[model samples]
Target: MVAVLVIMTAGALLGYFLRKQPKIVMINDKLIMLAVFGLLFLMGVAIGSNPTIIQKLPVLGAQALLIAVVGIAGSVVAGSVVYYFFFHKKY
Candidate 1:
């Protein structure tokens, strides 16, 4: 955890110093996307190689879907409440 935070802080400081360089910014964006896709592909491969997960895929899919739906519903309800209270203007 400390190492992760230290690396992240170092990266943030580097990025701050490099903020004026558009070329570096563009390269950084591409690198970030490549890293994300690589991690996702590796994760899929790991999950695919697990037989237990394969067997429970259907149930896991249903649970994931339920959790996602509930999360979205809760976010929408909470956001609406906040907007109504703080940002909405009466006619």
Candidate 2:
């Protein structure tokens, strides 16, 4: 995982440098969206394939949903606080 992350970071830096060259163009949003959906679908399929996991999901679904909601809310609140403090530039 660390190696993968390092490789991805290196690739992103390389892309950023190359993008400063004159001939580059932005990628299409449609392709980006399609790649996102494809990755999400594959993740779902991997998670769905475990029969033992699927069997217990009914009992755990509400707990999972609650955790997910709380996590999302926490991230949004944290992001807003960071932005207000650092990016507002008025202080």
Candidate 3:
């Protein structure tokens, strides 16, 4: 919840600034790449240090991939529904 608030505040600030300079957008691929790489590094460290985790990897890996795919799909659908209800009408 706190993280959501912080992101909302940051997004608001970025939007406000962007209005003043329509040519400039705050979010870009580089930021996304940085975040993705950072998360991957952390996940790698966690997986590397846990012997039990590694041992169970063969069984868990497929399950994890399926869960991740489902979660991503659900999130995308939810986001689209929320945006359609909240913002699409305005545009």
Candidate 4:
């Protein structure tokens, strides 16, 4: 956990210092996308390798779907409230 925090802090500092560099920002974006894809692939591999997990996937998937739907609904409601209060007023 400490290692993760340290790495995250280091990345944040590096991003702050390099904020003005468009090339570096582009590379960073690509690297982030690649990392996300790699992580997802690894996750799929891990799931595929576990028979018990596979057997439980239907229940897990329904729970995940419920969570995702609730999350999206909450975000939309919260975003609408913020927008109405902060940005939608007539100037």
Candidate 5:
């Protein structure tokens, strides 16, 4: 967990410093997409090799779906509130 946090912090700082470079920003998007797909592919491979997780996939999927729905709903509510308070009047 600490390693993950350190890596994330480092990436955030790098992105912040690189924000002024449009070429780097454009390349970052493509690189991020490639990295995400690579990570997903590796995750699929790991899950495919795990017999226990495969057997419990149905339960896990349902829980993941529930969490996703709740997260989306919360985000929408928060976004609407922010828009109303901050952006609605500007428009």
Candidate 6:
């Protein structure tokens, strides 16, 4: 946990210092994209190789779907309320 926080802080500081350099920013974007793809690929490989996960995939899928539905519904309701209170004209 400490190591993770330290690494995150270091990355934050690096980003802060390098935010002004356009070339570095472009390179950073590509690096981030590559890292995301690599991480996703590794995660897929891990899940594919796990027999326990394969057996529980149906339950996990159902839970994920339910969570996604609830999250979207909540977000829509909250956004509508905010808009009605702050942005909608009373007239």
Highest TM-score model number:
6
lDDT string for model 4 (20-88, tens) is 999999999999999999999999999999999999999999999999999999999999999999999
TM-score of each: 0.83, 0.53, 0.48, 0.69, 0.57, 0.83
Range of the 10 consecutive residues with the lowest summed lDDT in candidate 5: 82-91
In candidate 4, stretches whose alpha carbon ends up further than 4 angstroms from where it belongs are 68-91
What's the C-alpha lDDT at position 41 in model 6? 100
Candidate 3 per-residue lDDT, tens place, 12-89, comes to 887776776634554444676889999999999999999999999988999989999999999999999999998896
Q: Across residues 1-91, which tens digit of lDDT does each residue of candidate 6 receive?
A: 9999999999999999999999999999999999999999999999999999999999999999999999999999999999999999998
Task: Please write out the lDDT profile of model 5 over residues 1-91, one tens digit for every residue.
Answer: 9999999999999999999999999999999999999999999999999999999999999999999999999999999999999889773
What lDDT does each candidate get? 0.99, 0.85, 0.86, 0.97, 0.97, 0.99
Could you give me the TM-score of model 4 versus the true structure?
0.69
Off by over 4 Å in 2: 20-25, 28-31, 68-91
Itemize residue pairs with steric clashes in candidate 4: none
Candidate 6, residue 33: the lDDT equals 100
Model 6 TM-score, all chains together: 0.83
The superposed Cα distance between candidate 6 and the true structure at residue 37, in angstroms, equals: 0.8
Error of 4 at 6 (Å): 1.9
Clash pairs (backbone) in predicted model 6: none
lDDT of 2 by residue, 1-91 (tens): 9999999999788877877665552453456688999999998998799898899898689898999999999999999999998888883
* Model 4: lDDT to the true structure: 0.97
Q: What residue pairs are clashing in model 2?
A: none
Question: Cα deviation of 43 in candidate 5 (Å)?
Answer: 0.8
Residue 29 miss distance in model 4 (angstroms):
0.3
